[model samples]
Target: MSADRSSGGGVSRRQLFGVLGAGAAGAVVGAAGGAGVALAATGGGTTDASGAAASVYPYFGAHQAGIVTPAQDRLHFAAFDVADALDREGLIGLLTEWTDAAARLSQGLEVAEGGAVGGSDYSPPTDTGEALGLPASGLTITFGFGPGLFTDESGADRFGLSARRPAMLEPLPRFQGDALVPEMSGGDLCIQACADDPQVAVHAIRNLSRIAFGRASLRWSQLGFGRTSSTSTTQATPRNLFGFKDGTANVKAEETAIVDDHVWVHASDEPAWLAGGSYLVARRIRMIIENWDRVQLGEQEMLVGRSKGEGAPLSGGTEFTEPDFDKTGATDAPLIDADAHVRLAHPTSNGGARMLRRGYNFVDGNDSLGRLDAGLFFLSFQRSPQQFIDVQTSLARDGLNEYLKHVGSAIFAVPGGVAEGEFVGQALFA
Candidate 1:
């Protein structure tokens, strides 16, 4: 009950970085401290791994609105650079490992008395996410593997699981060489596990990373979304990031009929495995909580579709509760701010299409530069990026854009899952 940031047998706050666990914002901690340390652990010398770092990422989710939110906040993300030699054989081995790891997480693991596994080895975070207002997240774990993960044919190894294709997002202003976000940028990690108990999340990720990458290295981290529940929520959730319940505006798979009519495109060109999969990951987010908290309790209620304490739509009820869009002038009354993020991403407005969002907040180190780092990794899964594209294009011009910034971005074309010994995109490339 003590902050829950620490579990019962949790490692002393001392070990929160390595052996303990970092949060979504700061997980990028090195297995030791900086990327140099991480590189050293995996064979320090650089091997002429260079390329024209693309100035613009294709189909990035930067400007895309987020559907998942703080209530859905318990999450972690890790991005890794895969060792080369990833071919049909490597993919086979990789997927097999995924199936195995998924099995263990689904069943649960031996949680340390502190709720995390004990005796694990990792350096301590030089700093907890003080600027971010959240204690380091406990259990959440996320995964990312670089492009080489799938494309590299050499013996280079991967750090974790990856989306395998480029993603698209609208670009934002660039950072000077000293920015912290460049450090928090994307790649791949093995898994993302969030939970009520930080210890449970740590325990889950530690084992999950061990199994997926042989050794899980810390990378990028942060804490967000405060929830009343044990889930240790963060602003990463869909609703509150923009100061309102965000994802309620999204569409679900079961509601595919409606989605097909609006959001999705089942073209004859696409193959079968992608049939059920939808494209377009909308990631509209903001940090109005600070502002919301400032408003009179009653005023906050009228501004959002839900209540502050309950998180339910203003029409009535508790969190995870339904929103009453039908409250007549409630809609026209602009009870919800006109420029509010929720107002932009709603189904009645721009959310006619939906993307499966899977991302976490990130908080990296502060250097001689003026401050620390903060923002969301904001990821989405869709059959095509188009669905997400339309929604984001709408938000890019909305009111919520003031607080949030579209920083790092990239677009990856995820290929189909492989069959026996085939690399993921063997059908297209081979």
Candidate 2:
């Protein structure tokens, strides 16, 4: 082994956490007429009107931080497939290494002490140098285990962990209008890296992918910008490529009771290892923006069931006002269209189930037809996969589906948070 890693030089967790906001101190130094120091030191004690925390979120928590943390501006989401040559122990080793790296990176420190520079010049650096001068920017790296992690497509227990798989962790059923590409969907594991800065988010995924060099390989990845949902009430709802305010009715982090009921896997739930965990569903929905742009604004609003200006229900009232599905217009027809997205995706229409969504808008350049290959990269967390299933099934009739195509999809069992001494998903291995 090389002294580069075997020498064991890195910042300690206590030193990292107790430093009065060491994570983002660099970025806030001269902000807000010097109030930046307090903001940085206090782990973003100051908040704007939207209630968005200005900096740093603790990496260690009861549940993973990213799901409920205020939505960040950018995302780098990557899914990985375990290498066939890697065994169960190698998987555990890779996870352990990833946990340590995640803790350091989330705190705005390098992967190790020598980091991108200080180490011997003879060997490759332990941490990539791209993020050397960046702040934490509220970066969070969340891990998940997909169905194939435990068992192969042939149903062979690859890691001797098939018995521990969550019952709902199966591959998602194909729904209506699915034009999924095989290479773009599914993985044995996944990492979601989110941050206010695009480079910081990319750095996280890059380093993590490097760490998994031999154990696993990237299956698919998506880079997204301009968050499409707000996970906290303090954060304003953001719009998608379609230009309507999205996630107005989404579950907020402040709604503790609702979160417990709808987002987290309860202790009483089956599979004790995933007690505090949650299930995640990711979908790549390519929007037909060209066609959508040609539709009259009023017609677009009708399909969404909200005013284009204020995102208010067409039936009347403010953006936050509960939608009225039965209110009729002058022509004696319902104000909200029968197949409106708001009506179909609403909790009332989906067995009272809700998901904590933290999606992003993506523009992956252009297609062969000269159309912009852009859309929404949808991400949601729920207590069970069935919640998403029901909601998506109801969207079978959504008017918005005509302008949208489901291109990629995957579901993962996100295990509970890591303890100080434990690696992520340690309980599963135990």
Candidate 3:
């Protein structure tokens, strides 16, 4: 990819998450300054349905997020479609319109809203490894969906495209063609947004949500939140409800790994309009942390591969330190087993297709519960889902799975960013 993907069809590696600070350690970085990364002057100040900027970066080129922080800076997440609507063509059209809307949000001040169509050919998934190389602390988006998104039941308009919005639908997304509860694992409409100031993030999203609803004619959607807490730093790595330090062992961006080839599709193989860009999204899966805290610390470590207090490997090693995968705890002890959560999430195994994770802690509730609504709006990105699924599935049945349920999910095909015209994926569907 080119040095500054920031200028064109998709988000530049620089603008995206774990956006590495301007240094070699390549620690995670977030948009630190500037008037949202500006796209080439193509139009004028725009307004959204709620009168906010029409679109946001990683989806809309309207604003470039300055930096990412645990304080919750930018929204992170993905959305999926019910089986009935997420077919190959439908998926294509959906994103096309999203990008088109983003362009419209740009209002020609950036790139023309929508123009090209991607070819139906075999291609690799996206390379989130590149994301780790950028920086660990920044706002980035990732998209992924569960298998159930495609199903809808009798008289239920889960697809939303239905001519008759079904009454029996009960205003919820579906999985396996059945009516899903509010916390459906995979969502037809998913929107995850984060910002240092919770209110700013919410306001920004309300505008974007309004725009999306207006253009696509979408009904209600599932909104999830991931927050970074400055209140507590004793927790070495961040965590979700399961109380495990989620995403501690994934690969870092800029790290050399074959996983890149396996996950991401190269720009050379795609259309010219798409050059140095990639799609991104995030999912906020709320965790039941209080319940997690009740589990024995030893058992918790077994599930997360580290002590919750230190984020260190259960066998040994400090937070941010390399784990001793080879060390057996005792003469007959199984130290770091292959199936361990941290072990599986470790980048060394599975072609190293480890995803880069940067999420936060959010607290919401009345004084009655005295509890914070915390969980990872588990955010991540990939050129494809196969490998990510492989590793994730293994962890799902692992020790910590029960404490956490996959609540919200979404998937979007991000187009590469090119310069000569508008953002990729805009023209075709619009």
Candidate 4:
């Protein structure tokens, strides 16, 4: 909540960057005038792994930060509907302001120059002041454009962007067994905020939502914790709410070849503005917790096609071992069932369509019927929407689907990243 710039009411784009650069170098002093906190601990600047400030991640890069930046422990995913009255220039201005705010937030600074207390006494505070003393905690804010951002549901071009829309940016086709909620499905734009601390993640979204006051309004949002997948080999595979290791064979950031092939869009792809970006497929899969709890351990393992404890495939040597889909048991049946979740969603079953999953477990509280309203917020990024479609289509008869329901679904075309001094999606606007 410290002021890094002039004691003015608002910041111009030119002045915002000045604050971003210098704000990190200033020591974070306690509001009570107590001892100053180290720069590494409270956002004066970031440091190496040896220091507490190592958690801070840079906001600007060639590719967006959240996609492969080692999935954080917490998430606040929000979808926004742009105002129908806003014009193209107004939308551009919103993105420009968002870019400036994201850069400052990721670096552990406040959203605006004066922040919470440094602004005018009569006016409202710039920042919400909830995350005042917190470190960045590896914060990352990713932005994406949904199909409606270009063309409305009625097929009318809203901002002359229908022509620029990627052919692959359309709404996802209905999948079998999908009981999706309409209110939770689509949006004109989306933001994925992640951090090690849940408060930090929530703060990012809360402030951004506030910033979108007039030009855009939040449609729906999901809060998730306990990441279900790991994006890097350095991290251990996390479990889903079902107690099974998820995304064990997910593409890792270290696998640059696989990432380039299956995750990032290429120059050869259409809509060159998104060449370095990727497509995001988000599914809110609600778990039938009460029903699944009644199933025997062996049956649970059978459905998932892996050991409940080790997460190893039935024909595997360890957690990281490859599944021998063809391996048979003494009963002359395949060790991994034909309709098992693993077998059905495997690359071999989906034409080598791989995804970088950054899923998370969520428990929204018990329902009126006393069932736990919990499930996995399935999030994956791929080169094209077809990659997800092919895999999801292959899982039509997945045995695990019996204990799960697809409650919410959305897809967005995430642009590359923000270059220094440029707003996000600048290529598309240009």
Candidate 5:
């Protein structure tokens, strides 16, 4: 809980108390929990044993924030293409600036001294004013380096990073039934900002984008609300756009063994700098809601291999029941369809491979046909990109594929968290 006092003044004790009090009251009324509670109730917040209102995650850590952190309610994910004119030092400076700004933001402070109006009217504001009075809201900003940062499509090294690229950092292969859009598919860098308030999340990204003006340009951005997966055992499983509970078996932060085994990269796995890091796979899967809604309820259940109401396996058990893929129904057909989403995507079916999912549901107005352009902004972290490929490959034959189309995809190498004096991805440059 060390404060970054270098820029904006450290968060006041009163401000911290205020946030904790409000968070506790909200949690009591069922309006807040998960990341909100994690921030306020845990040591991250300023509250003492009795619980008061300040919550903040340290910006510097062993692993990046937002991945294992409890999933926040809103997300503003953006990918950026580094300016061709910038050299290695310029990129490092950008990362340093982003790290400093992120530290202040996570503590609910402005981006710089004399935030917003504190600066002279003749010059641009140091911080955007929208989140002036807001609490930190458990905001976490995570950074990642994509394959394109190391080398371009033409295979030319871009930043003298080609030799350091981890084998798992290559572009994701086009999967069957993918409808990826070229413009939305890749970038040299990515930043994932998650917060309890949508405005807070957006503000973080906006200011970061502004700071990167000449060095990096946003390639594509997505706004997501209502997380679809729970990263902590304390959180209730949330639903996807389809209304079924999602990520029931996802790796939880409490599962230390599972996380280390399935999520974090080992030293021997690749380039040394990424030893404690992980690979991230992002996919914008557009859900065909209209078509899915037309299907019969029973068929929908069959396709998902779980009860619509309780989200239990069709074989009969609670939501967290270990699915019995071998169970048989009256007709002797497997109780869970062989191609059912849950069945196909299960670790048992994918050679015990698993990824930590932190996805969110998104609704982006309407498409050209006037249909809702909505789906899940699928985000997952894994020890190796191959783990995602294997599970996704198995899901290619799933019945659920008919109701969704993969419109965008990208993969990034998430380096280990930074020490107090270092910036994110500093190892790659070294």
Candidate 6:
């Protein structure tokens, strides 16, 4: 809750360069065996081997900060539609501005040179003051481009760069249990800001939205709490609203080979600009709480193909045990039902396709009937969009489908990270 001004307070644009220069010097010295080198000379807090209090992911790197980064506890996901008035040049300018702001914010610094109160009293504050005195809290901001950004509804090349659109960056197909609401479905651009503290995440999005005023308008936004998946082996698996362990088979960050093969796109993957990027698929899956809570314990176990308590496969084993799909019960039937969620969604059954999931549980008050309007804001990243499509298509027969409805969905082509002097998606614009 306290502001960290360890490096120095009230930094200007000019001061940032000096700070970065020092950081580079520190990196060089660290490579030459300095005593305990920091990740960046900004002097962000360092944690012990346990990674307990201080964990910071650098903003500028080969890949964006949030994708493979460990999941944060809170989320602020906002989607925007580019303004028709913004031509190519204007759009690029906005992106450049956003990149600078994101970099500063992610490093636990103010969005602008003067920050919130340092600006003129007569003008609106450049930086929102909500997270004024907060640490980075492991904040990470990720950007993506939706299909509509390339072409309009009528299929006109609005941006004059439609030919550059990645082949995998298209609208998601309707699934069997989809009850999609148009307002929450598609967007021209998206930004996902996550952090351990809710205020930090919200503040990041608020400042970005302010910076994007003339170029993009918010389509819809969702605030999520209680992450439901673990992205790294260092973290423990978290449960979803249904009370069953989720993302048990998720692609972990430690699995470098699998991450490279299934998550990051290659140079030969059609759109050259998106070579190191990845595809993101988001689904707002609403669980029918009243109905699901009424189901019998045994029935719920059957639906998920795992134990409700330990989250172990019904065939028997620990939580991380590979599910034995061939095991038969006393009645001579397959132990894990063919329509069970785990069975249908497993990689072994889906051509070895996998996605790095970073989902969070959401609750939005209540519905008209007084039932809680809540669900999982399911988010996943993969090398190819088809990998997600194939898996979702196979889940059409999942028994869990009866108690769930896909209310909102979107897909975005997230380009690779920005280099020190470059803006996000700069390669595509070039």
Model 3 clash tally, residue pairs: 75
As a whole number from 0 to 100, the lDDT of residue 47 in candidate 6 is 44
Worst 10 residues of 4 by lDDT: 25-34
The clash numbers for all candidates, in the given order, read 94, 2, 75, 1, 5, 0
Worst 10 residues of 2 by lDDT: 24-33
Model 5 Cα lDDT, one tens digit per residue, 116-142: 998888766789889999887778899
Off by over 4 Å in 5: 1-33, 36-54
User: What TM-score do all the candidates reach, one by one?
Assistant: 0.50, 0.89, 0.55, 0.89, 0.90, 0.89
The candidate that wins on TM-score is: 5
What does each candidate score in C-alpha RMSD? 15.4, 8.0, 14.9, 8.5, 8.1, 9.7
What's the C-alpha lDDT at position 44 in model 6? 30
Error of 6 at 377 (Å): 0.5
On lDDT, the stronger of 4 and 6 is 4
How would you encode candidate 2's per-residue C-alpha lDDT over 1-430 as one tens digit per residue? 1012232333355533432231110000001101121222112323344322235667766787688777788889988888777788778778888888898898888987788999898777888899988777778899999999989999999889999998889999989879998677998999999887788888998888777765677788888888888776666677888989999999877787888899999988979999889999999999998999999998999899999889999999999999989899899999999999999999999889899998888888888999988898999999999999999999999999899999989999998887786788888988
Q: Least lDDT summed over 10 consecutive residues: which range in candidate 3?
A: 23-32
lDDT per model, in order?
Answer: 0.37, 0.81, 0.39, 0.81, 0.81, 0.80
lDDT of 5 at 392: 91
Per-residue lDDT, model 6, residue 121, is 92
lDDT of 5 at 20: 33
The alpha-carbon deviation from the true structure for residue 179 of candidate 4, after best TM-score superposition, in angstroms, is 0.6
